[model samples]
Target: MDAVHVHMTNTSNLPVEALENEYPLRMDEYAMIQDSGGAGRTRGGMGIAKQIRAVGPGIVFSARSDSHTVGVAAGVDGGRDGRRARLIRNFGTPQQEELFSKTANIALAAGESVRIETPGGGGYGAPSARPQPRVAQDVADGKISAEAARADYGLSA
Candidate 1:
């Protein structure tokens, strides 16, 4: 299997110091992608996007899925679904950029950074087929609002 690996150190007062001390590089920022989940009957697993701003010049390597389009996960029988993954960066730039490569390796400067958008899980069945308890749990967990869950998932939450 293919994978992306990153090495960095932290120079700030953030909790990342431990990582920096443990690693051989420094990092200015790190975060996951916003929303990249899929929708399907069984709900495919969500993709993961990570970004790290280099505190200094360093090399970065990443491997990700090539399918930038989000697709509905195949449901067991019939269930509501989830959305796909979409990646965007430098939205204000005169021209939009799309990074659909399965692997990326580059040297970044202090102010340079990369954004990764992962895919979300797919729905298991028809939206109305989901259980009320599941919908309620989603609401409680802040994954979905009560109104949305009720209207979309047909739950009482």
Candidate 2:
């Protein structure tokens, strides 16, 4: 074994009081990305999807997360690859812009919103090895989609 320890900082709902009611940064409003985890017996930890609506003018945002593609967590035997991070600015606006995993001072004006999706962890084994009841629970909890439950865990006819 090597002398190394790693830690991942959860950027979800980052506490920023400056953007409080002034920017309507709803910290409690986070959802799990549906079907975002890798397929495997030991289901990968779900990722967090959050959207913040900026209300004040001249607001700046900064973030850094695991990258998609190369940085995606590698799955175990028979387990599919996990999803990677994503960031979207001005999601519904004509000025919408897609950003990289790490971004520096970005200006966000009034009425603009940003959506951030953190990466999911890698799976452990074959998806089919996962229980049907667990898949159903995931669906009901909105962590994974119904289609994923059926396709990944073979819970549907």
Candidate 3:
């Protein structure tokens, strides 16, 4: 029988400073992906993107993640589905490339970087039921873009 590893504590992301201090890497970006959540009466939570570069040679990269090719969180009650996850190598450069969701043991030279974008949660209820004030607030708070509010929530500019 396959045994599942269970933990009572909730998982948490490490701070950029801690990660850099402990590992031979430099954090490029660690921020929330704006407007990645599904649009709905109760909008879904946003995702996170983390980019790191190898500061030293002989860095072996590996990861076991999901939501890459398919199997994303689906919405309910007419809500929109969440965005997909991604693992990229050398993102935003001439040699940027997509890596497998379950890759392991990839050698990284110094200055080469990797980016992991986590998927957002699915929304609840119909987007038409969402209030205009809440949509405006989302825009004001930088959670969603004004264009997204207009397009997804049917709000006028």
List CA RMSD, all candidates: 7.3, 5.1, 5.5
Per residue, candidate 2 scores C-alpha lDDT tens digits across 75-127 of: 89988776777888877669888887678898877777788776777778999
Model 2 scores worst on lDDT over the 10 consecutive residues at: 1-10
Preferred candidate (lDDT higher): 2 or 3: 3
Q: Write the per-residue lDDT of candidate 1 for residues 34-152, one digit (tens) a residue.
A: 22222222333444444444445564645455445534434445643443444443223454455554546754455454555444454555666556776576567545556666566
Cα lDDT of all candidates, in order?
0.46, 0.71, 0.82
Q: Estimate each model's TM-score.
A: 0.54, 0.78, 0.87
What tens-digit string does per-residue lDDT give for candidate 3 at 1-157?
0011121124356778888999999999987777878888898778778899999998999987656887876888998987777899999999999999889999999999999888776778999899999998989988889999989998896
Pairs in steric clash, model 2: none
Q: What is the lDDT, from 0 to 100, of the residue 74 in candidate 2?
A: 74
Residue 11 in model 1: lDDT = 17
Q: After superposition, how far is residue 50 of candidate 2 from its true place, in Å?
A: 2.1
Cα-lDDT of candidate 2: 0.71
Residue pairs in candidate 3 whose N, alpha carbon or C atoms collide under 3 angstroms: none
